[model samples]
Target: MHHRRPKNLRKPLLGGGAFLLLAALNAPAAVSFAEQRYHAYKISRPAYQRQYGSWARVEVPAEYRVNAIHAALLHTGKVLLIAGSGNSQKNFDAGTFDTVLWDPVANTFKKVPTPEDFFCSGHSQLPDGRLLVAGGTARYEILDGEVRKAGGGMRVKNESPDKAVTLKKGTVFRSPSGIEYVSKTDVTVPKATREFEVSYFGNGAMKPWKTKVTAAEARVFVEAVEEGPQALTTQAAQYEVVGLHGEDADNVYGLAQKLTTEKQDFQGIRSAYEFDPKAEKYVPVDPMRDARWYPTLVTLQDGRVLAVSGLNDVGDVVPGDNEIYDPKTRKWTKGPTRYFPTYPALFLTRGGKLLYTGSNAGYGPADKGREPGLWDLEKNTFTGLGGLTDPDQLETSASLILPPAQDQKVMVLGGGGVGESEKSTARTSVVDLSKDSPVFTDGPDLPQGTRYLSSVLMPDDTVFTSGGSGDYRGRGGSDVLKAQFYDPGTNAFTEAAEPTVGRNYHSEALLLPDGRVATFGSDPLYGDRDNTKLGTFERRVEVFTPPALHRGGANRPVLGNGPAEPGADGRATFATEDAGRIAAARLMRPGAVTHTTDVEQRSVALELTRGRDGRSVTVDVPDDRTLVPPGWYMLFVTDGDGVPSVARWIRVK
Candidate 1:
């Protein structure tokens, strides 16, 4: 029966890999998709809204509330956090900064020099050990490597705030770095307000903590624009910081998103600049693709560059279209698929599925940002497909989860509906892929509903959820130090023995490749305050290791109730498995099958009877008009227990 099979049909896939895959494609034939590349699934309910906070994994500090998150991976398997907030009320909208590192190796945390904490930029690791950062505030935060012009040098403000002025004159020299910037103003006003705002730009030197001053403070390149309608304005221009290479702070450059006047035409600002490690200056190179704002920059396995999404606006209330940027071609192309309007949440699953979860379209109750979605890159434009047991609502929640293994189950930690809630919920849901429903089990619920809670999955298949408050929208909130963990077997959650730091919006929990989990940030929604800061954003990193598992449960193999196989006790071996989850077995007994467990192995026993005329009685289970596969069998019956008393072994060919 082993003849040449059609290319479309490859059968008899046996093993764990096949078992897992079969579950995913259980209904492959029933789905008709427009793009063979991507298949779409439907949902009965519509998706819902936006959640605001500098709530994520950040370790930066400021004198104000934090509101943004930046993630990076170090060679040591440690996760670095650059948390910032642009809504600091200290001196108007001046933001704060902090740096946090979660070391997986040592299972702890450490603090590095603060990176440029601009708003809305992605971080990438370079071939060397340095980081390549791009985008954020329109004005830049330059740090490492920059080459001065052949006979030139660049000078930023270092003295009086009166040296800089804008046209309309509402406010001027309010540096994007959130520090004091001087303007070549009437040069008369003396008290322009001096706050502890720090800007890591100019000179490229590691100034341990120098206060920023205007150019007149023993510097050069002062300006006085007596031009056009924007006349007599001496505004200093700024650029975004890409890196901070202290020792060899040379050949550095800033990248910017292409500016658009009307939001349509993409005037491709394909510029690449070189930074002189010596002079600390910027030199522009030929452009590369169109400029993108807040796009994700990832290094492919093959050393290629890809820029995805952020093709819309920085201030956009919703996520936008997808696009691809190639480094070699220096070109931009639209991505084959559109992304779910998800925010503060995107993951590349262990199964190679791209997940975009929890986002609002506009502003409404229906738009409370409760939609979780997935996309298949193997095929293009394939998403809007998800089948939760409820199949109706999608709530926004965050957590850490270990991937599934033959002996391990994935656990989801603390997640609840976002935006405007009464109390914080500490519910933990666990998914045992080894089962059919991939159903969710309940874990401990927190005292209140943690709106923007954070989690990090540890190595031992256990999940850890840290600090999240019982407050909503920054109103009447209190600290939730009690942490929780999930156990799948019993489908429950319990409080961990330890307590975590109090946290609010824009905090992060990182699991280092080594073994530690770093927790930091609380950029509170109120004005910048210490208790609100958590100091988790500081250098101190906490390490945690959940207890190890002790074997106890019996066998739990994935099988079906298809038919009874001929065994000493009627049970067929799942040895001849396939990519399809549909399994079949035949019984040697003539009676119906019954479930009985022996040493954890399920089997059936049959009893046969003789008819009055001394002949055997038979019962038929029809395969009426179809040819079944070689392994998928039917249970033959003759009188009792669906087993055949005579001619028990029949090979149907």
Candidate 2:
């Protein structure tokens, strides 16, 4: 029906027609907005969350937020977050080390008094429920062009067999060419060793022995007293020890190689401490013999911690000067020498050997010590394992003993090329150490090549892996926000809830006592896609609730009135109303993680027996000390539906 319109109405009709045309042209954008809103609603629904899980960004109080470079789950049900200078040069200069204690249950935070810059430290759970934290940043790295002074390592010699020599920090060393360098740290050179050997003559008389004396040496970082090119030296030189005379002057001397205004790598400290969860403070212990940055501390079967691989005091790879810390003695002794890149992923096996998964984070020759192997600690032998895909891309990879650690299987997941290379891989490999000839076999690939990926062991017998970047330190805005669940039984991955935050270098994910996973830290190189702006350290901590937690109501089994301390191979009875549904029990080692390496987290299966009363469950702890290291563990009972109860702290003596 064609109808004539009045002149006044014609203009309004024309405007309305134009509006309709514009809305029609932008239909895709309107539809997209509506679809996004619907997707958000759908995921928030109980039904959808029960299947795919859910993620919630934790609202950390602004004052308590920290970089969280290191995270450890304590027996107190609180997480310790250490950010020691937080990778910030300004913070280091200001001496602003930080640590925050977060109680997930109470949602409260407390600031800790950090004594040193533990920015690149190594930590492990101690048998006494303390956290042994060792090594840290002694000096920040100075780039080549920014280096203002000439510095290098100096070897101080004590030629006197009678008395040792102590060189103070400001001790001056005069080079042969008259350039003076000052010691940057105190060093004590041991007295020369004197040995006498006797030879026995044929059946009757003893021949006189000759005495041998060997000079003792100690190394210390030295810097030219003066800055700039005038202090630079390109030749190795012997330096006269200042403030000495006569025999003392001759007995003490300094030797150093070329000291130049070159790039200075981050140096490490020899300081070590044990964080007491009960007292909520770091207690200083005996220092290590060698300074270390980016070290890895693994607990031995005897409960001693083996500290290995890091940059030493002079900003050099530690030259395999590993040491062991005896918790009982509170001292460190020389360990068997074995070189590895910094923060190597080493797991202790049931046979007391360490399984090196060929996964490391930064600092070493790409060709050396990058092979996957089994290491004999007593004999100092390494047996290399083969068949790992993308062998060259093991740096920043995540390695873990797969669930039911008694199976003696370890897996390596996702890695990148050495250093800041742009290369990454999606490879996943598993090595069953129980095999006659253990070699890594390829598992399912990740959705994309990733680095700094965090793998957390869930009580439900699956691994939750999430948050990594496609490039080095998330350059080019390459942070991968995806997450997945890896089923060791199926040797495959299934998609899980996606993380909202991007975690890359220096990130960590740990399973909380409640079965949810808490993630922290991400220090990207740049904030923008174009890599133009410096990236801020991610201070926001995110928690992921796995599908098992969202299946229905809070019908989780509750552990009540269990033994506070139980001996290995002993049975402990726990009261729980849901004991009848308890299908399995596990002793989960609390996580102490940093730099994507956590040898501390493992789920050891316990033999479970439901009581006849249907209100109690008795579980037997394994007798093997290597299989179940002595420490405080979270006792978790899972139902047939894979729902885990809130953990109860139990000490395995």
How many clashing pairs per prediction, in order? Answer: 90, 0
Candidate 2 residue pairs that clash: none
- Tens-digit per-residue lDDT, 1-653, candidate 2: 99888899999999999999999999999999999899789879988778889999888889999998999999999999999999999999999999999999999999999999999999999999999999999789989898877998888999999999998889999988788999877888999999998888899789888888899998888888888687888777789988999999999999887788889899999999999999999999999999999999999888999999999988999999899999999999999999999999999999899999999998999988899999999999999999999999999999999999999999999999999999999999999999999889999999999999999999988999999999999999999989999999999999987888999998999999999999999999899999999999999989999998898358887888878877454789988888888889889999999999999999999999888989998999887889988899998888898999989999886
Give candidate 1's TM-score: 0.43
| Tens-digit lDDT track of model 1 for 533-641 | 3223222334443332111112111222222323433323322122122122222111000000000000111232223443322223222111111111223222111
lDDT for model 2, on a 0 to 1 scale?
Answer: 0.93
What lDDT would each prediction earn against the true structure? 0.34, 0.93
Candidate 1: Cα lDDT at 411? 35
Model 2 residue 236 CA deviation in Å: 1.9
Q: Give the total clashing residue pairs for model 1.
A: 90
lDDT: worst 10-residue window of model 2: 562-571
User: lDDT: which candidate is best?
Assistant: 2
